[model samples]
Target: MNRKRLEQILDVSLTMFREKGFDDTSVMDICNACGITKPTFYKYVNSKEELLRHYYDGALETLIQAMDEHEPSNDYVALIWIGLSMTASRSIDLGPDLLSKYMILNFHEHTVTARYSAGGKQRTVEAIRKAQEAGQIRNLCDPEKLFMALKNLSLGLTLKWIMTKGSFPFFSHYGRMVEDIILPDYDTVLKQTGVDHRKKTG
Candidate 1:
């Protein structure tokens, strides 16, 4: 497949979905927007829902890349906070309606959403293991359980933010939750970890 052309199709489809809503947007609409024929569009993606999955999968890949670049001294807890904050900020950019649709799709088990979600959890588990090995994280609890709890909490908060139409300061509120609730020693470990969580770039 032509990588550039595929990206163009996904970008155009995302815009159309945002403006017209997923239910209203058709394959022909995306084809027209991208100056491509329906057959050409079909060659890239099988259906509109597939295009939506591509959008989410791409977004999660971007987050994983960001984490890899900024990973700090095996500090899994801090990394979790950074990922959650970044996701909240990105969701706000995508707009509440579109983000809600993405979240709803994410609940289904057979899409790229499920794959990305599982992949993210696996990455977090690895990070948690490293942190435990390095004595940065206490090993008293199961790493997998801890990671799942953190992931679920972040998702719930994000869903609540979307449901509220972005009225809440999700990024800042999440940061506070990390500091005060989830990781009370977040700042101290971050200092030791030598990772700047605030310097994420696009």
Candidate 2:
């Protein structure tokens, strides 16, 4: 399946859902919006709810691509921080409303949640090892264990944003949480990456 075509379907679906509400937005409504038939839609996703999973997974593509293109000798800690910054931006773009739906759906289908992100999660774990070797991350951090912690943190932050309706300075808060809890010395990482995440995140 053409991934661009799949993205198109997801984009149109989001727009329709925002305007029409998810419950009222039928598969045919999305199909009509994307100019794809039901069979074609099914080829892209098993169901509309699955689009939420695809959208969630799509947020990681930027990080994966960055990791793929990154030089091995560069600051691995900075690389991880920049990748996650982009991932956080992508999550915000997905909108809290959609994220809430995704959270609720995944809550009921907990087993399927991690299944959607297996490939991306593996790549992130690989990056974690690189970061650890660079001395950017504390050596005490176990790669897989750290990955689970960051994953849970991402979900928790998403819930926080939804509950607040984005009233807070999200990126700044996210930066503090990461630096203080998830990724130590992450401020230095952001500096090395040349990312003024404050500007980018807002």
Candidate 3:
């Protein structure tokens, strides 16, 4: 019933769930591993799904906080580097399968799940908007559109990196590619837009 005991249970359950998945992990599996009885286990949680929700919820909150705290950088290239580094650090603590599986399982369950996913996308968009406003990104297209484009590139890079087990090293090259994308149209938009988006929040 205490916080420490609950945290221990959650940690144990997360490891087991990650290794064997939700369906394969049972209350008995958790209890036996933790030296607790079924009644004792039930005191903290009702089911495996609830535990998944807890982990998912905590991970998403951490991600949002990281995005919020990223230092404001002038250029899109710099921002991409900063963003990927933040992402790598956060993803390192959890399994690589965490985001993909959570997205697959909960993307359609409720408005809150949809909001969590959207919040990530929105953060990326806002970062780009801030960069554009700062005159650090090209302005040939809409800020939102540019954000989506950059997001797609990042997603592709992430998938490639995951498939190759870090062989591609997207983090090393992402900033340069982002720079290439924004540099061609920098002159027109850079001068026309002066909103200073780094000050905005999502």
Candidate 2: C-alpha lDDT = 0.70
Pairs of residues clashing in candidate 2: none
Model 3 over residues 63-127: C-alpha lDDT tens digits?
Answer: 56766565432344344445434444343334445544444455456433322256566666666
Ranking by TM-score: 1, 2, 3
lDDT of prediction 3: 0.59
lDDT of model number 1: 0.67
The model with the greater TM-score, 2 or 3, is 2
Residue pairs with backbone overlap in model 1: none
Q: Name the candidate, 1 or 3, with the larger lDDT value.
A: 1
What is candidate 2's lDDT per residue for 1-202, written digit by digit as tens? 9988988998899889888878799999999888989999999899888887776665566667777777454566545556556666666776777777777887788744432266567776777787666555664478778767766776678679989887776677776666565454445546556544445545
At residue 53, candidate 2 shows an lDDT of: 73
Q: Which residue runs of candidate 2 sit more than 4 Å off their true CA positions?
A: 1-5, 35-44, 57-61, 112-116, 137-139, 182-202
The TM-score, computed over Cα atoms with residue i paired to residue i, of candidate 2 is 0.71
Q: State in Å the error of residue 123, model 2.
A: 4.0
- TM-score, model 1 to reference: 0.74
Q: Which ten residues in a row have the lowest lDDT in candidate 2?
A: 111-120
lDDT of 1 at 190: 55
